[model samples]
Structures are given as structure tokens and as C-alpha cells.
Target chain A: MNVPLDPKTLVAEMSPVSTSEHIAAMKKALLKNIQRSAYVYRVDCGGCNGCEIEIFSSITPVFDAERFGIKVVASPRHADILLFTGAVTRAMRMPGLRAYEAAPDPKIVVSYGACGCTGGIFHDLYCVWGGTDNIVPVDVYIPGCPPTPAATIHGFAVALGLLEQKLKAETHVEAAGETAALPHPDIPYALRVRLEREARRMAGYRQGRDIAEEFMALLEGRAHTPGSFTLLECMMEAIAEERDPRRAEIIGHLAEVVQQAIRGEAPRGETP
Target chain B: MLKLLKEIFRTGEATVKYPFAPMPVCKDFRGKPEHKAEDCIACAACTVACPANAIGMETDTAAGSRTWSIDYGRCVFCGRCEESCPTSAIRLSDDFELAVGSKADLTRKAVFTLADCACCGKPFAPAKEVDYVARLLSQSARSAEEADRLRLTASTCPACKRAQDVHHIADMGIARQMTQELETTP
Candidate 1:
């Protein structure tokens, strides 16, 4: 005899597994009076394992997540908390669901890392489901590329309701007459651009901007102060005082650019 | 046992009291990207440079406003946003305890008004950005008249600027023709 099968059961459903109201109440109760150690079972939904490394380090002697009795277990059957990592790739979705199902009712789900929290840089990829919350109900999100061990501990505390979350949603509206202050208004715009470009070329962007700002401040201070030393002499003195050879060299290059501007000479390789 | 206990005492505690006491992060630690909206021009440089698309800007032409938002969950803490910011308004701070119970709490937003184009009277760029550019150009201008011209150019929309350039180029062509005719006659 031929058997008829339900097409709905045959096809893999894309909908997320929903927890019942009873389970939600139990989970809330569990969170409220969780006196025992919460055993965490890490489910790798298709992670790069950066989060795994950080998680392991959090349990190490330095961070010592075990101090709060947060233990990482190998089996989902023994888990009170299911820690999901990665963006939940298509192939691993079933396994992730399986791990979630294996854990007993009232289990807290923690979405770990940038990938697990929001699919990170790979959110738009074709094969990934984007985030753990897309596949399961996430109770807590520990967001970082891979959170530092201390951050991980903080996340665990938040998950266990032992600590209050520090981050709150904020929105700022622009007021009337709001204006961004021009950096180094004392320096000529052309000279400022040239100095910043030279400094950025020598050092990286963040450090370069910092160095340029410092150099401009020094220039402005020297100009204001009635000193016998000329601008060039002041720069040389500043460079001599700089302990770091690398920073000294960058400052020297910036000074040369300033000298070029003063003398009406074009920069070395480019036309005026 | 006594010797082991003494050795342990000598070594001191290695485990940090993190949640109980404030954890000290190292200097230059890349953690949270704090956006100072007061100093931000909403230039969209950080939005373009973001590899994760965590920082985004939504422009509402009808409302004449631009909304700048950053989702901390999607941010990789790479500091690219901090590096690409023109006004140094976005900087990475040491506030890394960013775990949250809800996803909505992970987002930060800023709303800025758009500036009307000087020529067209239509909203083109953010008001703060236009003001900043105008001020910068005027600061570098050689003469008062030149400063005024530069400020006008900075405030004009890109489309209007292009149209003005074309008209100016046509006027220059007519002038060049007149000069050529006069030189040939002489």
C-alpha cells in the first residue's frame, strides 16, 4: 500500500522555533533565583572560533569565569545556558536547532560575539542566516568582534541577571547654530592640510592626526610666546626633545612642509 | 600543604575582580566608538569606510533631515569609523562592557538638519557640514571678496555648482573669442 506524506513536514521550514509561554515563565523564574552554577554549552553554528578562543580565555586563571561558577560543558544535555557563536550558516542551522532543542526547558540563550549577535561583517553573505536571534530567541547579546575576557565575564553576569546592563539606547537631535569647530583655526588652512597629509603619510591615520595636532599646538604656543628662537629653531628644539625616534622623524617632516610654505616653494614632487 | 599555601600567598591573586570591581583596560584599547554629535558634520565618510555597515546614514529629503546611526552589535570594533571621521567626532573609547538584553539598546542615533543650497534653495548637504566647509574656505581666502565667493561656492549644492561652472566656462569662451579677434586686428 502507498503511504501519503505531508508536504509541510517533508520540506525544511525556515521559521524560528518558538518557546511557549510556560517556558518563558520558567526561564524568567530561573533567571530570578538562579542560585546554582549555570552550565554553558557552546554551539558552533559556523564560527571562525575567535569567540571560542575568547570564551576559553575567560575561563582561564586570569579572568577565571569559574569564580562565579559559570562552567562550560561539552554536552548540550547538561547545559543551563546555550551559548551560540557564528552567523548560523545554512548547513549548521539544523545542528544549532538540535543543540537548542537538546537543552532542557527554561534554558537561557546567549548570542556571543559580533557574528552571533548581528552576523558582523558577513551579515549579507548568501549562505549565512545573519545572527543567532534570527534562528532562536536570544536572551542576551555579547557584542564584539570577539569580546575581551573581562567583557565576556560582564556578559555572563548580565545573562545571569547578576549585574545591570550599562548600555542604553540614545538619540541626539541637532540644535540650532550647531557647528563643528575647525581644528587649529590659528594655522592657515593650506598649511594645516599639508602638515596633516605629511604626518598621515609618515604615521598611520589616528596617530598621524594626533601628531599633527600636537605639532600645530606647539607652533601656535611658540608664536604666542615672545621667544628669541624662530619657528624653525623651535621645531628643531621640539624634535630634539622627542624621545621616540619615529615621532621625531615625522615631526621633522612636518616642519619641512611648514618651511616650504613659508618660503613659497612648491612641495618636493608636486606642482604649486 | 603549608609550603604550597605560602607559595600561593607569595604569588598573590591572578584572577581579576571584574564584575565586583571596575576592570582596568589598557591605554589605546579599541572598544566602543563614541560619537560626539555636537562636533559631527555628518559627512558620511565613516559610513562609507565602515567594513561591517554598522554605521549608517538615512537621508529624508521630504523632512530635510539626515539620521546617523550605529549598531554596536554589528560593529567589529575595528576603529575604521574613528579613522575615517573628518571632524574627529567619532572616537573609540574604553567602554567595552556592551552586553545587552535587547538588540534595540545596542543602537545609537543622531539626527541633523540639512542645509538648503544657496543657488537652488533645496536641501543638499547637512547644515553643519556646509557651515564647516564655508568657514574653512573663507579662512583660507586671500581677500574679502575672494572669501565671500568661496563661502558662496561652499554653500551651493553640487548640481548648482556644476551649472554655474558651465555658464562661467561659456562666458570665458566668449571673452577668449573677443580677445583673439582684437589681437588679430592689431
Candidate 2:
């Protein structure tokens, strides 16, 4: 899985320039072609802006990918690569598809994070419409609720390998590290807890008709008696099982209670 | 091609010898905020100006406005705090080197000593700023009274200081800034 950029035997891009006089002019053109070939455009369908922020940090001073001639362009039409973030919301689906189509042939699409990859944990929601692969051909799928700048670069390194076949790179140049660029001496405990919680929610598979029926049933229910609640309330309550643990530990507690209840242990009471 | 290969081999390493030697980041880059407590008059202006609610004045009711806290964790580093400080008390510095193990650790705080006003004999601004201004206006005994009377703060009742917001001062002492004439020569 190690792919490296080897500039050796670089396709003699100038057709071997028949005469010695044209050699100097030919060399300049080849170098220009090498630099012109790398262009990436980032697209956010409806992301919460976490992945976008991380992606922005990547191009900054610390991870400066411009060193490798990779540049971030604004327009999708002029791009050679599509770096997509967010779960494909219903509104942005068509525009996202059009953007992918507009990026000319021989373009690479990188699914930027867990949200873009499998709809992440927000898939069960009503607003989210599709995962990344539904609309475009995704070449690389980065895993994480909002993949770090390092993870984004790691995915990019993989994409470069697929774009150009090559042997091992001599120096093991790893992707960007945030510790050096970040001001703080340590990753805040709050952020760590938040990211870890997101990791747990994106665990289940999709169910088409059955899921819709259950969801509609939840919407269509009304129970006024004791020990009974509306379907939406029940669904909202059930969301604990599917909730991304980053913000609150409430759903995680419910899931833990359910697992404990099934295991025949007396469920612990909620925090006051 | 052979010459290009030789050039590549001869090129120095790209990686910076960081930790041991840090790379110089661009000036004006928002990394971290540095506060100068000496200049800060404890106005709570930075707190009110901060859009993110990341900066605020934390104080006990009895102690009055004691400490100013800037939550770097929530701060967008918008520079609004620095921009709004009338005394230029808060200034953004090049030192962006901030990292924390906990969110609470990111909050920067400053506190000042309290002092009573020269005229009203009431608790007004911080001891040092009040003393410094008192010393400066000693020449014009009336200006010291003007400064003390006009020493407005959140504690100052707005109703009483309504006219004295410089209009009264202009009529009594300093002249008001000129209004533009209809036909002005540039």
C-alpha cells in the first residue's frame, strides 16, 4: 500500500525533441506540466464545518502541501480532484452531483470524513438524504466523524498512489501533525471526549423499507395512558442508542442501560 | 536529466529542525491572545465586545469587577477585544503557542486592585489607573474634579451621567470637536 512519487523516466513529455537545439525549450515545458497537473477543490454539501476547519488547517503553515505542487482551487469545474465533506443533504445532492460531473474526466473524488463516508452517525436523521458514494465515484474514504488534517493528507497520499503508479518513497514522509502547529501543549480533554463519542454512533447498517416503516410508525403513534409516550418522543428517546456521544453522555447511558438490562443486571439510575 | 538528478540529490532537507528550532510563522496570524493587565482599567469592555461570549469579567458582588477571563477555547480570536479596548489595555501578540489538556486550562484571567474615587470617595476604578490619572490632572484642580465626576463605569448610574458624557465637560472645560461645515475646503 506504499505508493511514492518517482520522477524518474518522466514520460519524455516533449516527444524526445528530435534535435538538440529544442532540448532546452522541451525541459521547461515538462516541469510546467508537472506543476499544472495537481489541483484539488473542496466541497461541503451540508457539513457542520468541523471537517472544513480541519481541512483548512492542513493547507496552513504546518502541513503546507503546496510544497508538493498540490493546491486548493475554489471552483469545482477547474479542479482535478474533489475533496468532499458532510453527509449529502437532500438540498445539496443535485449540486454535489453537478459539481462532480463538471470536474472533467480523470478526476479523483476523496470522501473526506465519516459523515461523507457512511453518512457517519447523522444517517438516521430526517434531513440527511444520502452517503457520499450514492452520487459520485469515491476513490478514497477517510474514516472519522471529522477527519483530522493528518487523516485528510493520509487519504490524499493514497489517492496520489492510485493516480500515478509508483514504487516506495525513500523517506517516510508522514501526513501533517497538529501538535506542532497547534498552540496548546496538549489536546483538550473536551475535544478528545467529543471525537471518541462520535466513533461509537456510526456502527450500524442501513435498512430501507423496514426502517422507513418503523420511523413512520413512530411518527404516527399516540399513547395517552401511563408508561406510554408518542412515537416521536420514543424515537427521540431511542436516539440515545444511535446518538453520537460527543456532545452528551445521555444516549450512551441509555445504550449502556439497555445492554445491562439484557444482561440481567439491575439498571443503574440516571445522574440527578 | 542527469543534471536534474544531481541537483535533487544535492538539495538540503525540507523538514525544519523544530522543537529545537521553531519555524517563524507569519505576523498578524491569529495564534493566541496576550493581555496586559497593567493597562487594563477593568472596564468589562472586552467582555461586552466579544461576540463569542468567550471573554468576560468574573467578579464577586462584594468585590465588584475583579477578574477578566478570556476563554481561549471558545474564543474565535476575532481581535474584537483588542479593537474595543479604549486604553489599548488588551493587545494581540505573536505568541500563539497555546495547548491545553482540559478546556478550563485555556481560559486566561486577569485581576486588579480596587480604589476609591478622589472626589465622591466612592469605589471607582482600579487603584493604579485612578492614582495615575489623579496624579496627571493635579495641575488643573478642576480637571481632577472633572475626571472624578466623569469617571463613568457600569457602576455609574446612567441617569446621573447622561448630560455629563462630555457635553457638560465641553461647556465647562474642554471644547467639543467641530462639526463639518456645508462648504468645506479639502
Candidate 3:
């Protein structure tokens, strides 16, 4: 059954709340001068609760965020830092704004998780506002699906001015005479394709690519070396030297593919 | 009190000194996706692989360029981009301290020039991709003429290639095609 939707409740794009110069100066002073304990209040604007779990874990004995005087309070009124988690769904927008208002002035607003930062996988959803910045001005953004406990502590340290942020905006423009180099220029393209296809069929994409790269490196290395042994003999020797059974098995299969290519036969396991 | 103190001393401190000390992360930790733009061909494979659309590419035919951008704020750190990158240009590094004061600081971009098509003279693909494919094809080509032909084929756009194929087929006279079709049918 489809429920009737209300057009009046829908929001397309809400501009981020503008902070006045006075308020901005006050916030800068608060960040610079404040040496007191920072009490964090978490506002769930409609999330999967993964960020909450990571937050809770950060406060646990192993992490013990209390060591730095960072405490998670029950009320937003007492919160020095407001940590907003989620994509800010339409239904939770009012509550999220209420929490933002409830926090005292000079409060540091933190957008937590990928969802809170940029709505994550749900950015295009009709109900989501995209990010916390869409509703209230955010002072910091902690991005991850659910940031690890260590990462959470690092984010807090960055917020409290204890640590500096590592990431910086970067842009690269194409330089003159710049070109991407081709991989394995010495190897025949057809043989490389056959080997890669065989390896990919055996393993998944990531591991398959890795295996193919290793096999190709070995192939190229053999070509450069002056040797009495044939290519097949070198491959057999390498296979015998391999310690891992699984990797050895994959190398053995790749060798078979190379042999088939040498014989001008079609790749195995495919309909003619 | 003495027994409690002794047990506490035996257990040692439970809290970890994180901020002051360098925290150790396990191997294969998926943290931030680092993009090596120099090695990236602007193929848009990572953009297509991104589940959250954190990595995106914009092609401008008028400008004759393709721009690749990645928003760290929206990234889920799933390593799908790393998996999809053919050149190993993008990989997840251990630097997880991604908190930024500004939203603009969370983004990275790379602009690459596009190669214009050989036939239509319109920007179609990244220049690096066309070059890389031509090089790869030439490596397997039997003769110098074949290699040059493959290079020409690689440089042409798909639309132009299709048009060439149609034109080639049309050059075979309609009467000849009809006779061949009739003979096959009989």
C-alpha cells in the first residue's frame, strides 16, 4: 500500500545556515581559548547506527577518550561539541536543527561518518538532505562508513586542536608532453591478454590482476636474463620454488595458458 | 587494599596512549583512497566502480578535456576504486586522519586532455587511453603496416568506425549482394 506524500514537507535544497562575523569570531576564540572538558552530544539524524557504535567504542576502556577530557553527555544543552550522524532525513531535520539550537553558543559542530559528511550511499534519496551542512554550519567533517575507534579519537584530537588535519585539497592539471606508459611492453599483447583472462577467471579481479602482474614480471625477468634453461624449464623451476600451494596452483595454470598460446590454440574452458 | 593494589599493578594500565603516541594500525587497513593522478589515465573506471559516487568524471568536448574528482567526505573506503583501477593509480593508504574544517578541502581533482577523433575531429577519449591502447595493440601486431593500421583504428572514435564499416559494406554493389543472398537462399 502506498501512503500519500505531502509536498509541503519536502525540501529540495536548504542553504547552510550562515554564521555572522561576530559569531564566527566567537567560534574562533572558543576553539583557541577553551581548555575545559569537551562534552560531546550525538544526534542521530537517521543513520544505520554504525557510527554510534564506533563512537561508543572510542569511549570504552581500550580507547578511553576521557583521558583527553572528551566525554559523551546525555543532553545537548551540556554539550560543548555536537556530533551529528546520518544523512539528515526529512523527518529528522527538525529534530537535528533542534539539537543544534539546544547546544550553547560557541559550540563546535562536527559532521560524523560518510552519511553525515555527504549523505554517503543515500545522497540521491528523496528523503535525505544530503549532509549535516545542509541544515547547520559544520566546523569539522569526520568521514568513513563507520570510522574505526582509533580514527574517531584522531578526529576528536583534530577538532580539539590537539592535532592538525592531514588531508588538503589537491588539483592536478595535465602537463605538456605527459603520457601514460603501457605495461609490459616486451610481452606480446595477445599472450598478456590470455594470461590475464585465465588468472582473472581463476581468482577475482583484485587478486587476479595481482597474480597476472607477478606472472608477467617473471616472464619479463626471464627474457632479460641470459640462461641455458628454456622458458618452460624456468617456469617449472619457479613453480617448484613457490611455497604457497594456492599461488603455485595459479602459476601452474597461467603456465598452461602460456603454453596454449605458444601452440596457437584457443584459450581453454570456452565454447569454440 | 594491598591485594587490590598488587592485582592492579599486575594488570597494568588499561588505557592506550593514542594522541601522544603513534597508533599502530593492522596491515591491509582500508583508510583513505590515495589517488596517484600521474599514473591515472582518466579512464573513469573508478568513477563507475564507486558505490557512493565519491569518484566522478566530467568530460567537456568543447574544452577538449576530462576532469576526474573524488570527494573524500562521501567516500565509504570500500576499496572498489582500488579494485577497478587498471594502472594501480588509486589505492587505499593507512592515513585515516581525514577530518577537515572546510568541505572544499575534502575533495581532490585531476584534469586530463582529451584526444580528438581521427575522422570527425571531435574529442572522444582521454589522450593517454588512446595512446596506451595503440601501444598495446602495436606490440602484438604482426608487421609494421599492421601496427600502423591498428594504431589508426585505436585512434578513431566508435561512431566513426561504425560509419566506416557501413560505408565499406555499401561499396559492395546492391546487385552483387542480392545475387549472393539469392544463391545462399536457394
The C-alpha lDDT values of all candidates are: 0.93, 0.54, 0.89
| Chain A TM per prediction | 0.92, 0.47, 0.89
> For candidate 2, lDDT tens digit of each residue in A122-190?
655676653576566575666444554544555565566422211111211112220111111132323
Scored against the true structure, residue A32 in model 2 reaches a CA lDDT of 42
Candidate 2 regions off by >4 Å?
Answer: A1-272, B1-4, B113-186
The 10 consecutive residues of candidate 2 chain A with the worst lDDT sum are: A176-185
For this target, which candidate reaches the highest lDDT against the unseen true structure? 1
lDDT of 2: 0.54
The predicted structure with the larger DockQ, 1 or 2, is 1
Name the fnat for model 3: 0.81
* Candidate 3 stretches greater than 4 Å from native: A1-13, A200-203, A236-243, B1-7, B174-186
- If scored against the real structure, what TM-score would every candidate get? 0.93, 0.36, 0.90
lDDT of 2 by residue, B19-90 (tens): 224446564554456676655666678888877566776555456436677655345556778756645567
Against the native complex, each candidate's DockQ, computed on alpha carbons, is 0.85, 0.01, 0.72
Clashes per prediction? 0, 5, 0
Query: Rank order by DockQ, top first?
Result: 1, 3, 2
